[model samples]
Target: MQKTCLAFAVVALLQPALNLWASDASLAVFEKRILPILQASKPSSCTECHLSGVELKDYIFPEQDKTFAALVKADMIDLKQPEQSKLLKFIERRPEKPSLITDKVRVEEAAAFREWIVAAVKDPQLLKAKSTASVGPQVSDELIRHARKDRVLNSFAENVWSEVGRCAACHSPDKNQAQVKKFGNRVSWIKPRDMQGTMQNLLDSGIIDVDAPEKSLLLAKPLMQVEHGGGQKMLLGDRTYKQFRAFIDDYVAVVKGTYKDAKALPKLSQEVSQVSEIWLKIEGIPKSLDKQFLRADVYAKTADGWSKERVATGDRAIFGGGGLWQQHLTLTAPRDSARAKELLSAQKLAGGEYLVRISIDRNNRLAQDPNSDFTKEDVIGEVPVRTNWPSGYGAMTVVKLPAQTR
Candidate 1:
């Protein structure tokens, strides 16, 4: 009986300290990181979902909301076991699975918040918000020296050069954009215009870990395994992550002096033709005799949103110094014959419907301007193709377009 009383007394002594620590977490990490994601605007009314559980007749508007938010913070923001939080799982939802919360709570927005969540749980001082005074993780000069000497890293960077534009928005030094600078080497890989310099900086600064490439900050920051001022930019099991892993693997091989060129490697023959071949034919395009007309880029609506996943790029619709002309192109789309059946199991439909957006570059400049895309308003015309039951390859799917487009 004496021992039981002693235990109760000990618990009583610790309770107040626990409450104070929780209050700090609520004020610092909850307010600074998690709240923004919780408060993110939705496409429709949020009144139904974002409301307090407590019933009160005299409750105010946002004050009540704040009270509810505090309840969530208390429940969801556990300092002892951060990863097991139901709130985290609710946000990291998959499309095929039933979502705990609506898509309004973007998982991408959780990257920075998660970093704070993990850090603040362990150390209350880490709850402080990032500021201009905030400093980045320090890298070693020796690591940079060795990474620079690796020729495989060079080749890997060469392959990524074409796709460098994808990283420009968050990784550049432009004042208008967030200046995420990489240390070592004068060249700035962050620059959208300079891929080689960007690669040099990326390697020199240690974003691509040669030792364990998958753990590299390059992949982790974008994937949100690590703290990124930018939110989650890439999904874990997607093509983009796979691509980064492949390149980083090659870079590691180079770092260890065991690098082998991918082109020189033996080919593995596999009959894995999974995508539906699309036959796109562009006809009735007028080409001015004096003007140089260029090619067209085709974008299709895939499982990922409409703008993402470029399906094809057509040949020059109308060549330079030519009259009205036509061209044939083949595009490939993910084979969804089975999944389409499941999506519309009850209600019958022909095939999967997709909206294909086509943007033509009249000048063939190929977007010389760093800031512009091939299908910019100042450059050319756009055409839309709505395909419900798209025919197979060489089926001659025709996309008709107007002469002028605003």
Candidate 2:
């Protein structure tokens, strides 16, 4: 009878489909087969790491290249003889004898994976496979389809040229205009060409950081009162500053191939009919998205007054705005996990009127920070959004909420 019972217990422990068993039944097997091998115990409760009590649902395993799920899908573990399973190989290799676990007593644990698996398979409280906590962030199917190299560039281009960040200004389209004009409409009055010379000049002078957007002087030129042709200081205001930042973002994106090419640019902005969730779309950029550099900031407001968050800060400047870049921010109740359960407790927010301020040092690296020379109290009209990026490159976006949701 004893040999028969031991065989039955081992069979149950090794079975693939059985993840949990009754606590009492699991304890019965643990007392007989696994108790003598333990070396030391852990401070963590026995059930925390064991299958009989808490199971593995609450625990998060380390990011493994080949996760247990893939292993199960590959049919590597045998359910009938769990002690002889490959999964048990890992547990048994622990530095303890007889018992597979290293922890000592007072913290009675699942000594071997065989013991744990047997308990898990029989436990009625074990979570279903779908409920495992090891899942990664969820991405939409549409976004996945658009992730092709060409489609990513297209989306980037569309986002750039919209009313948010108008690139056609300095980059003109044969619009007849006057020769040399004032600071406000210079791009509108001029033509577009390779800025390599301009950038090189700044780089040689140690103004811009080499190949880094956060330290580039080209990003800081437009927002200042620097000597253009005359000795006079010319100023680019808040609105112009933002548009210029958006332009650099596009320039970097296109150069990097985050935008597919000039041809795919227009199709990048095709508007969608519906928005079910927060949708982030990029298109028309070429392949080299990470090589270029740029910076942008996004801010939001709540009833408590003001709060801000940095949206993107990296070497790749793939995202651009149409001047009207729409960011759908969902503000949930503070740390209220129960808000999802209580319908009335959930706080819903639509778009609200906010401010977006951007500043750029177009000299590729000439102007020092506006705050350094000017008084800190005197809000320098150029880049009022107080976030730092590489020298010469900086951007800020202030969005206002719509009066009412549709």
Residue pairs in clash, model 1: 189-198
Listed in order, each prediction's TM-score against the native is: 0.29, 0.20
Best by TM-score: 1
Predicted structure 2: lDDT: 0.32
**Given candidate 2, what's the lDDT at residue 88?**
51
lDDT (Cα atoms) of all candidates against the true structure: 0.45, 0.32
The regions of model 2 sitting more than 4 angstroms off are: 1-68, 71-160, 163-219, 224-237, 243-406
Summarize candidate 2's per-residue lDDT along 278-353 as a digit string, tens digits: 3222233233322222222233444764444322211112233321222222222222234323322322323543
Question: Which stretches of candidate 1 lie above 4 Å from their native place?
Answer: 1-159, 175-189, 259-406
lDDT of 1 by residue, 287-367 (tens): 442233344455655577554544444333343233433333323233443432332122211344344354544444442
